[model samples]
Target: MKIWGYLSALTVAILFGVWFSLDKTLLGYLHPIVLASATYLIASCFLFIINFSPLKKKILKIINSKSKVEDFITKKEYGILFLTAIFGSVIAPAIYLNGLNRITAVNAALLANVEILFIILIGVFFLKEHVKRKDIVGFVFLLIGAIFLSTNNLQNIHFDASLFGSILVIVSCFFWSMDTSLSKFLSHKSNIIYITALKCAIGGLILLLISISLGLSFSLPLDKLPLLLFIGLVCLSISLPLIYFAIRIIGSTRTGSIFALSSLFGAITAFLVLGEPLTVTQLSFGVLMIIGVYILYMGDNDQNV
Candidate 1:
């Protein structure tokens, strides 16, 4: 089961890696806020279908769940979900997208690593989640690999943008980290679909409202609808569910650490999907990240308690 948890995290890394590439591509069609709002809203709708579907009872039996989505989550969980949605699905994406527009991929990847660090700190200090000695060592390995990959082994350095963009990325990462830690509260719950749906609904609606107030263009090209659907239905819907499930079994700290590889994986996917060059240095450090994850998995000492 623990190994399965590890695999689920790995799968999330891949799925989100794909999402990052797709997200970058879709920005040409819609405003960042609009794209984000659409993706999250669509994801929420998909989850809503599952939650209230006629087959919901059968699905419950499959997962051995007793509670229905309508009443399973408590008010406390609702509060946590609302906060997480604001930090992650709302603020983080908007800031991260704007930041991405300013900085090079190199700087973004390096700074984005703060997400996992924040997660670990919150998980250990605030959440009181325990990790083994092996966890520390593995995290070191993972961080080292991430650094090398992010900097491209220090081969070609570029600081094209001012520090403002970098700061935005870091700030956005902080909010995302907050979301990861807060969502840990729901990791023990049975209704992942409800958790994801409500979070997305709240986040998406808020973003939509912000866009409306700012009078941002919501003109989505019809040609872009397929990719839009894919992003919302596949990335947010599928990826987030997998993330919540993995968090349930593995804890948010480790899961966030492993999921951090998504950027490294994104580099690889960009090469494949966008016809970008794949450097040998990148391939090397990418493998190192994988090794680090394996080491981390070797030390799943506590099941988030």
Candidate 2:
């Protein structure tokens, strides 16, 4: 079961990497906000169907019966959860997808490593979680690697599409870091299914409204409907639920490390699928990012034992 959990985490990362690649392709036809809203809406429906199924009834009952205070959840708990969805799911993806349109997938993936640093800062200062000295060193290496990859196109920065894209990706990382920590707290009381469903549903609905208010065209690309549905089902619905379950079993530190692996997967997918060039800077930084995550994972295990 534990091995399954680790595999699931890795699988989620790989699936997300695929999603990022495909999503970039799809962006030519659909707006980022529309894509994100549609993906999450489909995911919500999928989760709701399973939650209402007979097989899930017993689990649902146990989750509902768990008292918030006793389980470290309260009315305030739901508030934080909802905000996490708003920022992390709704806002973050919208920004990221739009940003990816302007950036190479490899750079986007490398820049995402910034989330680890944000997570560490949040854990130590805001959440009051302990951070080992080794973790700081690991983060420093990761940051340096990310910086190297980001500046590879320094001479072309003005001509490159990645300038604004990188900023959006960093913002997305902040929201994601917050979401990860908050979800860790909420998972103690709520069924992973319940929390995931609620987040997607609420977040999707909010994005839908925002899309409408902004007068963003929601016209479906008739020819691309199949691709859209495939993304919605496999990437959004299946990957997210399994990700939550992985978080439950592995703890957030390990989960974060595994999640970071998505960058590697993204880089490879981008090279193959998007015909993007892979540069030496990207290669060097990618290895550094992976090593940094491995160190974090190792540190987490040592502390746990």
Candidate 3:
């Protein structure tokens, strides 16, 4: 079961890596807020189908034996769920899309590694989740690898528009770290589908309102619809559910640390998807990140033992 948890985290890393890579191109077509709103709204609709589908009650019965049909989660848990929607689904995507607009896909993916550091801190200090020395050492390697990949032999470093964008991406990571910790706790108290659907719907609505208020263009290019649907279904819907499930089993620290590899996955995919050059230095950094994830996984296995 724990092995499955690790695999689920890996799957999330890959899917989100693809998303981060692909979204950079989408940003060229749509406003950041508009794209964020559309993706979340579409994902919410897909989740709604599942939430009220014919198989819903049966699936809920299998997954949530303790949950009453009417009210399984308390009010306090509901409040926390609302926070997850605000931070995770709403604010994080907004900031991330903004950053992705300013920077290249590879840079955005590399900077996303900061999310691991934030998650580890929250998981350790606030949540009182245990992490071994080995875990810290592994994350340190991940940090170094991300920096290396981002700088690319320390060439053309500038503190201008790109730097601000990187900062925005880091801020987005902080909110997401909060979301991961909160969602981990809530996953045990509520059904995963319910939690996911509510977050998506509420957050999507909030973003939609913001977009409308700002007079952002809501017109979806007919050509971009396929890409938007892919982001909605594969990345937002499937990826988020896997993330919540992994968090429930392995805890936020392990899951977030594993997600550091999204940078590596994104870098590899960029070669094929975006026609980005994959240099030897990038390849080396990717290898180091893989080792970091392996070290974290070993620490988790030791804890389970």
Query: Judged by lDDT, which candidate is best?
Result: 3
Tell me how far candidate 3 lies from the true structure as C-alpha RMSD in angstroms. 2.9
Order of candidate numbers by lDDT, starting with the best: 3, 2, 1
Tens digits of per-residue lDDT for model 2, 32-145 = 998899888988888888777885667545434533323345788889888889877888899888888888887887777777677777767886777777887788888877
Locate the minimum summed-lDDT window of 10 residues in model 1: 62-71
Stretch of 10 with least lDDT, candidate 3: 62-71
Superposed Cα RMSD, model 2: 3.4
Total clashes in model 2, counting residue pairs 3 or more apart in sequence or in different chains: 0
What would you estimate as the lDDT of candidate 3?
A: 0.78
* Global Cα lDDT for candidate 1: 0.72
Residue 92 shift from truth in candidate 1, angstroms: 1.6
Candidate 2 clash pair list: none
Q: Per-residue lDDT for 293 in model 2?
A: 77
TM-score of each: 0.82, 0.88, 0.88
Overall lDDT per candidate, in order of appearance: 0.72, 0.75, 0.78
State the number of backbone clashes in model 1.
0
Candidate 2: residue 203 Cα off by (Å): 1.1
Q: List ranges where model 3 is wrong by over 4 Å.
A: 61-71, 130-132, 150-152, 301-305
Clashing pairs in 1: none
